[model samples]
Target: MSGEQAGWALELYQRSVLKQQKFAGIQSLLGDTAGKRCLDIGADNGVVSLLLRRGGGDWSSADLAPEAVASIRSLVGGRVERIDGGPTPFADREFDLVVVVDFLEHIPDDRGFAAELGRILKPGGRLIVNVPREPRWSLVWPLRHAIGLTDQWHGHLRPGYREDSLAALLKPWFEVTAARTYCKTFSELLDTALNFGYVIKKRGQGEGGSTAKGTVVTQADWQKGGAGAMKALYPAMRAWTALDGLLPFFKGYRLIVQATRGSD
Candidate 1:
C-alpha cells in the first residue's frame, strides 16, 4: 500500500482525550526542531513526521509496515524506507533526533532496538519515546477484559512499560533527561466504552458483515466515521483532557521519555 492509503483508519480514532494529551506532551518535549535532522521510527501514518516537518525539522520516516512507510513518504515527501525487525538501515549517528512513539511494545528485541536508536543518533542527540504503561490501574485490566476491549487485536507484544523498567532499559546508551506518566481522564474512559461497543458490534457481524451484499470492507471504510466524529467531539475532548490534568490521583495510561545519547 502507498503511504497516503496507510493508517487512514487509525488516524480516525486518534483524537480521543488520551491521544490529545499525548500529542501535546510530545510537542512540548520536541521543543524547537528547526534545521535539525529528525527521524521518526515506526512512523505510523507519518503524523510525527508531519509534526516535526512543520516545526522546521528535516524529517525522514521509517516503518516495518509497507503501507505505513508508503503513507509517511506520501505525507512528508522525504526519504521513507521499510525496515526489518533487526538493526536499522541508517548510518551511525545519522540523525540529530529520533522518535519512537508507542512503537516499542510491538518489537521483540527492545534492547537491541534501543541500542540501534542510540547508534543512529549523534552524540548528545535526543530520543523521544512514548509507550503505554503496563498493568494499567487496578480497575482498568478487569474493565478492559470484561468488555473485550483488549489491545491484543493491535498486535501488542507486551502490555507496556513501567518508569523504572524503561529507565533501566535505556540507561546503558542514553541518559534519561526527563520522564513522566500521563493519566487518562473520565472522558477518555467514556470514549473507550463507546469504542468497546463499536468493536464488539463489528466483530459480531463476522469478517464481511461490515460490507454490503457480501462485499469486503476495507480498513478505511470501517473507520470512515471516526475522523468526522472525532472532529465534532474535539472541543468536548479538550475540555475533558483539561479536567484530567486536574485529577492527579488517577492512574496514568502512558509513559513518555526524553533521553539523550551518551558519548560513544
Candidate 2:
C-alpha cells in the first residue's frame, strides 16, 4: 500500500477495532434502540453513538479527547459532547442505554467505572460493554518487545477479572440475564483464541461472583499456527463462529454478558 493508502488502511483498522461485530451483536441483541435515551461514554470516535442513532435511539456521545469529539462531530454532523475530566457529567439515571464499549480497560478504577454505569442507567436500564480477554499469546512478548509493540502487555487489563473474577465485580450493581462467551475460534490445536468479549444486562442488586474458571491458550497452541497454516484451517474457522454462542472456553475470546439493573 502507498503512504496515503496505508494511512487510510490504518484508519479503517482503528474503526474496525472500535466498532465491529461486537457492536453489531449488541445492536442485534438489544433490538431497536428507538425511543431510548442512549449515552456512549468514552466514545472515542462516536461510532457506537452513531450506530445507536442509526438504530433509532436518541443518541449522544461524550469523549475525553477534543479531537475525538471533533471527529464525531465531523462524521455525524455535530451535537457530540466533551466529558470534563474523568467524571461522567450526566444527571443520575438519565439514559436508558449506556454503552461503555472499550472504555473500561483504560480506566484504572474499573469498579468506579462500573458504578458510573450503574449510576447513569435508569432502573432496569442496560449497559453494553466490550473488553479484551486475557492474552493467551503471552509467549510472543519477546518478539513483540523487539518490534517495539510490547511496551505494556495488556496495559489496560484490570486485576481480578479474567472471566470468573469479572462476574464478581459487576454482579453487585447488575443482574446478569444473558451471559455467554464470544471468542475467535480457529487454528489447529486450540479451537478458540480469547482476545476480547462483551457483557449484556439482567436486573439485580449486583452481588455474588462465580467460581468458574475458563481455559487459556498455551504457547504450544500458538506454535501450531505456522506459516500457511491459517488458510489450511479455514474450513474449521466457520465452525468456531457457529459454536461461539454455546461453548465459551473453546472460542478465541472469552465471555459476552448481558446484565440489567436490580429490582430491589
Candidate 3:
C-alpha cells in the first residue's frame, strides 16, 4: 500500500463507525478463541489481533504495508509480517483460525489470495471474512469524495460483493457455514452522515482529518471530549442501531461470512 492509502486505512480503523461494527461482528463470530492459532490478515491497527490475544489465542498479524505492520506492533506486541499481493511467509497449515475483515474488496487477485488462505489453514480450520455488500451507494461517492470520505485512495479495487458471488469465490477451497449482513439502511445512512460531519468539522478546524499512524482512536475518543460532531451523533447512532435490530430484512451495507476449509 502507498503511504496515502495506508493513512486512509489507519483513519478508517481509528474513527469509522463501520470499522467498529465490523469488529463487533468478528468478535461475535469468534467465540472462545482461547488456545487457537489465529492469523489476522490485513490487520489495520491490530485491534483484531489484540482481541484474539486477549482471548488467550496465539495471534499473528499481517499487512501489505510496512507502516501498518509497525503500527500493529506498537498496538500489540506480536508476530507481525509484511505481505505483498502474493503468498505469505507462513508455513502451510499453520493456523487454526484466520480472519480477513474488510480485506477481500481491496485485492486485485482475490482468487490467488483465497488459495493462499486455504494453503495456510489446518484441516477444517475456520475463516471469517467481512466485506462490503454489492450495490454500494454510488450516489454518495461524489459527496464522499468532496468531503474526503471515500476510500478510493485506499486501493478498494472492487465495488462490493453479493452472497453468491463471494461464496463462489471461496468455494474451491472452503465451505460457507454461516453468513450475515450488517449496517442496515437506517444505520448505514446515519453512520455515513456522522462520518461526513466529522470530516467537515475537522477540515474546518485545519486538522489533517486523516488519523496519524499508530493512533487507534476508540469510543473514548468521542466520549472523552474528542470530536464534538461524533459526540453529538452518538446518541442518534445508538437509536439507529436499536431500530436496525427490529427490522432485519433491509439490505445491509456489509456482508460477513464464516467458512471452514475443505478437508479435501
Ranking by TM-score: 1, 3, 2
- Decide which is better by lDDT, 1 or 2: 1
Clashes of 1: 2
What TM-scores do the predictions have? 0.81, 0.62, 0.78
Better of 2 and 3 by TM-score: 3
Among all windows of ten consecutive residues in candidate 1, which has the lowest summed lDDT? 208-217
Per-residue alpha-carbon lDDT of model 2 for 98-168, expressed as tens digits? 76554566555777767777877888888766555555454433443453232133334442135555666
Q: Candidate 2: which stretches are off by over 4 Å?
A: 1-19, 84-86, 135-146, 151-161, 183-249
Candidates arranged by lDDT, highest first:
3, 1, 2
Q: What's the number of clashes in each of the models?
A: 2, 29, 0
Model 1 pairs in collision: 3-70, 3-71
User: Could you give me the TM-score of model 3 versus the true structure?
Assistant: 0.78
Model 2 local distance difference test score: 0.51
* Model 3: CA > 4 A from native: 1-20, 136-151, 197-232
What's the TM for model 2?
A: 0.62
Residue 207 accuracy (lDDT) in model 2: 20
lDDT of each: 0.70, 0.51, 0.71
